[model samples]
Target: MSWRQARTAHVTMTFDPEGLTPTQREGDACVACHKKWPRPRIRIGRLPDDTTLFACPECADALLPQQDDTHSLPWRVAFS
Candidate 1:
C-alpha cells in the first residue's frame, strides 16, 4: 500500500472502539497495562486470532510490534 493508504488503514484500525461498552471503557483495565485511563481513552485492536485487545498509547507502543520497520524489512529480518 502507498503511504496514504497505510496511514489511513492505521487510523481506521487504531480508532476502533476497542469492542468496549461505555461502562467498560470507563472501568476496564488496558489489556497491556491493566489500568483504566481517565481522560481521552484507550485504543482497541484485534489479534490475528480475532481476540480484542485494549491499550493506552504508551502501552500500545510497547505492546504492539513496530509495523513501520517490519514492513520495510525482508521477511526473514522482519520475523527475526
Candidate 2:
C-alpha cells in the first residue's frame, strides 16, 4: 500500500477513562501530559465511549507510530 493509503488506514487505540482526569476525559487537556494551555489539537485516541482523546504535537508524535522515512536505511529501527 502507498503512504497516503497507510496513513488514512491508521487506527487509533482506545483510552480508558478510569486512569484519566476530568479534563482529559472531557478533551480539555492533553491526554499524555495533561497540558491545558494551547489545547491539545491532535486526536491521538478515543475513550471507551468513543470520546476523542487529544494530545499536543510532541506527545502525539511520541504516542503514534513514526512514518517510514525515505532517507533512512532500508532496515527500520524499532525503539521500545
| Model 2 Cα lDDT, one tens digit per residue, 1-80 | 11233232147789889999999999999999999999988877888898988898889778887776765445355332
Give a tens-digit lDDT track for model 1, residues 1-80: 21232222244243244555544344355655556654324445544445444566676556445556535667697588
TM-score, each model? Answer: 0.37, 0.72
Q: After superposition, how far is residue 67 of candidate 2 from its true place, in Å?
A: 1.0
Where does model 1 exceed 4 Å of error?
1-27, 39-51, 69-80
lDDT of 1 at 22: 47
Tell me the number of clashing residue pairs for each predicted model: 0, 0
Return the number of clashes found in candidate 2: 0
Best by lDDT: 2
Candidate 2 Cα RMSD after full superposition onto the native fold (Å): 7.8
